[model samples]
Target: MRRQAATFVWRAALAAALVCGIGLLPWLTRTDPALTVLKARSADRDPTPEVLADIRAQLGLGDGPLRLLGQWLGGLWRGDAGRSWISGDEVTPAVLQALGASLLLMAVALVVAVVTAGLVCARTLRLGAHRRLDGRRTAGSGSAVLAALPEFLTASVLATVVGVQLGWLPALGWYGPQWTVLPALALGLPAGAVIGRLLDDLLPGAFAEPWALAAAARGLPGRSIARQAVRRCLPGLLPNLGLFVVGLTGGSVAVEQIFDIPGLGRTTLQAALAQDLPVLQAGTLLLVLLAAVAAGLAALATRRIAGPALRDGALSSLHRPQPPTRGIPTFVHGGLLTLVIALGLPRDPLALDTTRRLQPPSWTQPFGTDALGRDMLARVAHGALDTLLLALAIGIVALVAGALLGLVARVSGPLVDTVNAVPPVLAALLVTSVAGSGAATPALAVGVVAWAPLAAHTSALLRQERAALHVTATRGLGAGRWYLLRRELLPAVLPPVTRHALLRLPGIALALASLAFLGLGAQPPSPEWGLLLAENQPYAERAPWAVLAPAAVLALLGALAVSAAGGIRRARPRTSATLAERPSLTRELVETG
Candidate 1:
C-alpha cells in the first residue's frame, strides 16, 4: 500500500510538472510577451527602451525560467493564480467565473449526448439480425458525418438554421437557459455520434455472449437483455467518455467564440491572441488539471464497477496487437475526390460582385454573397479543394516520413525514443518559426507533429513482425533484408498504415482549421474553411449566410471523410468472438436469477 501510494504521488507530480512545462511555452517562444502586450494595448504607440524595460519588470521578465516557475508554484500553493496581463485583474476569480459557464455548457452537452446515444442504441437493438446490420451501416454513416464536422462549423450551421433563419432561438449571446440549447446541440451531436458508434461496436459482441443467450432462453425481453449488455460495456465506455469530455473542453474554444460565450476557452483564446502570458498560463494550467482529474475519476469508476481485472485489462489493451480495420471502398473515396475537383475547377472564388453584397440565398446567388460581395458557394466549393488537398498532403508526408523513421528506429531505439519525447506542438512551433507562414506552413507544422505517433506504431509493429516464424523461414531460404522487408513485412504493415491514414484525415483537417483560425495557417482571402470561420465571424449577425455556407461545406467534407473511413472498417472481417472471452461474473448472480 505504501509503495502504491508513493507511485501515485510520483505520477501526480510528473503530470503537474508536464502541465507547468506546457504553460511556459509562450515564454519559451522568440516573440517578446511584454512587447506583444504593449503593442496590443497601445496600438500605434511605440514603446521606448525605458518603457519596455518597465513593462518587462512588471511581468517578471527579469527572472529565469526556473525562478519564474518557482514563484508561480509558490503563488499557486497560496491559492493565487497571478494576475491577468491585459486587465491586471486577479486570475482566480475570472477563471472561476468562466469555468462555471463552461461547466454549465459541458453538463448540458453531456446530458444531450448520453440521452441521444441511449435512444439510438435502444432503437437499433430492436431490429432483426439482417435489419440490424443495415441499420448499423446507416447509423455508422450518420455518426461518421457528425464526427467529421468541426465544432465551429456545426455551431454556425445550427445558429443559422434554428436561430437566424427560423426565429426559434437567438443567433448570438448567452443570456439565459434558452441560450444554452443551440451550443449544447452543436457540442452534443458529435459526442453522441461517437458514443453511439462505440456502443454499436460493443453490443454485437455482448449479444453473442452466453449470458445473453441464457437471458433469451429464460424468455426475457430484448430490451432487458440489451440493458445487461450495456452494463457489461460500460467499463469500456467510461474511459472514452472521459477522453470525449477532454476533447469537448478543448473544442469549446471555437464554439464559445462563435456564440459569444465568455467561457475559459474564449478567455484563453483572447489571451493567446494578445499574448497575455499570465492569463494564458493560468488557463492552460487549469485546463490540464481538469483533464487529468476527469481521466483519473473515469479510471476509478471503471475499477469500482468492473473490478481491477477488467480495468487492468482495458489499460493493457493499449499495447496489445490488434487487427487492421478496413476503410471505405476505393471507388467512394475516388468519387469524393473527383467531386471536390469539379467544384473548384470552373468558378473564380475571388471574383467580387459589389452590387450583391450581403445578399440572402436566392436563385442568382445559391449560397448568397459575403460582406465583401464574393459568391459564397464558389468560395466554399474552392475552399473544399484547398482543405482536402492540404490534409491529403500532410497525411502522405507524415506516413512516408514515419515509415522511413520507423525503419531507422528499429536499429536505434534509444535515439528514436528521445526524439519522440519532444512534444508535437513544440516541434510544430519550431518548424513554423523557420518555415514562416504561408499555404504550406500549416501542413508542415501538422505533419511534423503527426509523424511521431505513426513512427512509434510502425516501429512497434516491425519489432513484433521481425520475430515471427515466417521471417525465420524466409531467412532460412536465404532471403535478403530488402527482399524480406518487401515480400513479408511491407504487406503486413500497409493495411494498418492505410487505415491509420484514413482515420487521421479528419484530425488533420481539424488541425489545419485550428491553425488557420489562429492566424498561423492559410491567410485571408484564401477561402480555407478555418480562415472563412475567422474572417466572417464578425458579420455573423448581418450576413449569416456567409458564415453558414462555409461552415456547412466544412461539415459536409468532414462527414464524407468520417463515413468513408467507418465504412471501410465495417467492411473488414470480424476476428474476435463476442462474450466468450470476457471475465466471468460472480457465481451468485449466475445461480440466483
Candidate 2:
C-alpha cells in the first residue's frame, strides 16, 4: 500500500512537470522576440552601447532558453503568470475572474447533467425489466432529444423562445442566476446523453446479476435490488463520468463563446482573436490544468472505486455461479445488445418539399426538414457518420497519446501535476485562429483540443487493470508483461473501455455538431447538422419545426447511442443460488389441504 501510494505520488509529480514544460513553451519562444523588439527600439532611444546593454541586461533576453525558463519558473512559483501586455492589468486576477465563472457554469451545468442523466439512466437501469424493453428506449429517446438537439439551434431557440419570445430570462450572460439556464441546458443535454447511456449499461448489469437474484430469493424486495445493485454498479460508472467531465471541460470553450458567457472560455475566444500573449498562456494553462485535474480525479476515482479485477471478479462470479439454475442470460443480454446496436444504425430525415419551407413535423416528413428542403431523417443519418467518425477519431488519437504519457509517468518518476498542468487545447485555441469554415475542421478542431480525455481515461484504465487480480495471478504464474497484459489485462479493461469509447461518440458529436451550428464549423453547402441549423435559425420563430426536425433527429441519434451502449449487456439478476440452490424447490412442502 505504501509503495503504491508512493508510486501514485511519483507519477503525479512527473505529470505535473511535463505539463509545466509544455505550458511554458510559448514563453520560451517569446524570449528572443521580447529581446529583439526591445533591443530594436533601444537603438532609436540611445546611441550608446551601454544603454543598449542596460536594456538587454534588464529584460534577461541575453540569457539562453534554460536560463530564461528558470527565471520564468521562478516567477511562476511566486504565483505570477505576468501582466497582460494588452490589458496592462495583472494577468492573475483577470484569469481568476474568468476561471471562476467558467468553473461556476461547469459546476452548475454538471450538477444539472448529473441529475438529468442519473434519472434518465436510472430509469433504464433500475426500473426497466430488460435492456430491450420500451422503457429503456423511452429514456434513450430523452437522451436523444438532448444529444440530437443542436446547441446553437437549441441555444437560439431557447434564446428566442424562452429568452425573447417568452421574455422569461436573459438571452446572453447577465452574470446572474437566470442567465445560466440556456447555456446549462445546451451543455447539459449532451452530457445527459452520455450519462443516460452509462446508466443504461450499469443498470441492466445490476438487474441481470446473480447477487441481485440471490438477494431477491432471500426476500429482498425489487426496490432493494435496485438500490443495492445500483450502488454496486455505480463504481463501474465513475470512469465514464470522468471522461464525460474531461470532455465537457475541454468542450466548454466553444460553448462558452456561443452563449456569450463571461467565463475563461469566452475570454479564450478574445485571446485567440487578439493573440494576447499573457492572456493566451495563462488562459490555456488554466484549461490544461483543469483538464489534468479532471483526468487525475477520474484516474483516482477508477482506482478507488473500481479497484482492478474486483469488479470483473464480482461480475464473473455472478454470471457463472457454482450452482445450477435455468439460464436467464440469453434474451436479456441479446435484446440489450440489439437495442443498443439499433442506435448506431443511422437514420436520414431530409425532405424535398420547397413549397412550404421551414414547416413543422407532418405526415410527409415525421421530423420536418430545415429551410433547405433536405430530409431531416437523411441529414441526421449523414450527420451521425460525421460526428461519430470525427469524435471517435480524435478520442482514439488522444487515447494513444495519453496512455503512453501516463505509462511514462507511472514507470518513471517525475512531477506529473506539472505535465498534466500544461494546457494543450487552451494553448492551441489561443495560438491558432480557427481557419477554414469547412465541416471537417470543427470536428478536427474538437478532436485536437480534446486529446487529453483520451489519454487520461486510457492510462487510468491501464493502471487500474495492472492492479487487477488476474494480472496479479499472471505474475504469480510467472507470466511476463506481454503474456499478462495482452491476454489478461487488456481483455478485462477493454470491454468497459470500449463501452465508454462508444458512449463518447454522442457527446463529441454534439460538441462538434454544435460548433458547426455556431458558424465556427463547416462552411456553406457542407450540409452538416450544426451548419444546417445555423442556416435555418433565422426562420426559427415562424417555422420552428423546420429547425426542430433536424434537432429531433440529432437528439434521437444521441439517444440511440446511449441506449445501445448501455443496453449492451443484460442478465436476469437473481439471488445468489450458490448458498441457496433452488431454495423453493429444495424446501418443497407437502400440500397441507
Candidate 3:
C-alpha cells in the first residue's frame, strides 16, 4: 500500500509539473502571453503597454507565473479550464472534444497494431514449426522494413497512393469510420512491426521450454503450442504495449496534420503555435493524465497476466532480455541507397531554377527537383549528413543516459515509464512552445522519450542478470554493490543496451523528420528529409516524384537501422534459456515421461 501510494504521488507530481510548465511556457521562454494573446486576438492592432497591461489583467497573468499556475489549477479542480485566448471559447469543451477524437483514433490504431503484430507472429511461428530455414530470417526482414518506415512518410505515401491515386480510402478529413482507416494504418503499421519483432524474438525460447516439449509429446498441435508461447511473451511485451498506446495517442501530431484530423495532437499543436495557454494547458494536462492512466492499466494487465508466479519469481525469465542481431545486410542496403544518392549529387542543392521546378526524374536529375527547383538528389545527399549525424548523437545520448539511469531501476522505473509515455511529437510541442522550433528542438524532444526504452531494456536485463549464480557467489564473497555493478553488471548490460540503441537510430532520424515535417524541426529550404516531404506534400498531386524520392530514402534508412541491429542470424545470448542439446524426440520423451 505504501509503495502504491508513493507511485501515485510521483505520477501526480510529474503531471502537475508538466501542467505548470505548459502554463508558464510563455514566461519561461521570455515571451509575454498578453502580447501573444493580443496579437492572436487582433493581429492588426498595435500592442501598447497600456493595452498589454489590460490584457494581462483580464487573463489574470499580472500576478506572475506562480499565481497563474495556482489559478489554472484552482480552475481545473473546479472543472473550469478557462477560455481560449484565440477563439474566446471555453477551453474545456474544445479540449474534451479533441480528447474524444484522439481517444477513438488511439483505440482504433491500437487494434490495428495488435492485429498486425499477431499476424506477423503467427506466420513466423507457423513457418518455424514447419522447420522452414527462413522463418526468423523472413519475418525479421519484413518487420525491419516496416519498423524503419516513419509514421509521417507512411501517412504521406498511404495518403497519396491509397487515398489519391488508387481512390480506395479517404486521404483527408475525420468525418466517419472510413476516415480512420488510412490514419490508423499509418500510425499502426510501423508500431506493429516493432512490437511484432520483439514478440517474435521471445517466442523461440518459449517453444524450447520443457512444458512446450511435453505438450508436443502429448500430441498437442503446433498452433496450441504457439498460442501458449505467445501468452508467455505477453508479460514481456505488455509494458511496451502501454508505451505504444501512449505514443499512438500522443505522438500522432504529424498523422493528424496529414489527415486533417481534429484530434488532441493537432489541437495541442495548434494551441502551442498560437500560444493559447488555456487550451494548451488543458490539452497537456489531459495527455499527462492519459499517460498515468495507461501506465496503471498496463501494470494491472501485467500483474493479471503474470499471476502469482510473478510475485514468487517463477516467471522472472519471461521478463525482457536482449536478443542479439546481425548487421551485414543493413550495411549493404544502406550503402546501396547512399551510392544511389551520391551518384546524382553533382548539382548544387541550394541552386534553384524556376524553369526546372517539379521536373520529372531524368538522367541529369535522378531524383527530380522540388517546388523551388532545388535538385532533389543534391538536397537528399546534403541532408543525409545533417540528419544522420543528429540521429547518431541522439542515439548515443539516449544510450548513455538510459544505461546509467537503468542501473537504478527501482528508483527510476516509474519515472521512465511516465516519461516514455510522452510522445516525441508531444515533447516537441512542449519544447517548441518554450524554446521555439529549431533543429535542436527535435533532438531535445526525441531525446526525452528515446532513453526510456533503452532504460527499460537495461532495467529488465539487469534484473535478469543479477539472478545469475555467479553474481550471488561474488556477492557472498563480499563484493560491494559498486563492484558488483561495475565488474559484474556493466559488462553484461552495455552490449545489449548498445544493440537496442542501434535498432533505434533509424527511429530517431524518422522522429526528427516527423518533427521537421510538422514545422517543429528544420525550417524551410533546409532539404532535411522530413522537411522536404512537408514542403513537397502540397505538390504531391502535380509531381509525385517530389514526395516519393524523400519517402523512399527515409524508408531505406529505416531498413538499414533495423537490419543492422537485427542481423542475419539470431544471436541469442549465451545465458539465454534453451532446451539442452539433444535429439528432439529424446527431449520430447524425457519431458513427457
List TM-score per model, in order.
Answer: 0.72, 0.67, 0.88
Residue by residue across 242-357, what tens digits does model 3's lDDT show? 77887788779889988999999889878877889888888877877787787678668767876565544444233223344456776788887779667746658899899988
Candidates in descending lDDT order: 3, 1, 2
Write out the backbone clash pairs for model 1: 326-568, 326-569, 327-568, 328-568
User: Which of the two, 2 or 3, has more TM-score?
Assistant: 3
For this target, which candidate reaches the highest TM-score against the unseen true structure?
A: 3
Candidates' lDDT values, in order?
0.64, 0.55, 0.76
lDDT head-to-head 2 vs 3, winner: 3
What tens-digit string does per-residue lDDT give for candidate 1 at 1-593? 88546645654565565546545655556567678778877878788898789888987877855676677668988889888777889988998888778878888999889987875565556652222423222344555566556666778777877998898998698888788889988888777865775566456555655566677778787777767667766665664476556556644776787789888777766776676666766766666566656656765775676564342332111112233234544356556546644754577789887887889988766778887888777777788788888888888887887777777642323223323322233334445645555667777767765664456446644544565444554455466687667655665555444545555666678768877776677887888877887777778888878777765655555556554544433222121222345333223223332
> Which of 1 and 3 is the better model by lDDT?
3
lDDT of 2 by residue, 1-593 (tens): 89768866765565445435543544544433343334334435544566556644654546744665565456767788776544557778898888887777777778878877767765554453332333222353555556556555666767777887788888876478888888777677667766665555445445555676577668766666666655665554555465555445545665676567767766765654444445656775676566556646755765566554454542331111122222343344335434433542454344356775665666765556667566655565565455556766876765555545545545422232333233233434322333433445565555554544434444545554565443554355465666555555454454444546555555566666666654466666555666667777788777766576556555555555544454343232232233246555222221110
Backbone clashes in model 3, listed as residue pairs = 326-566, 326-567
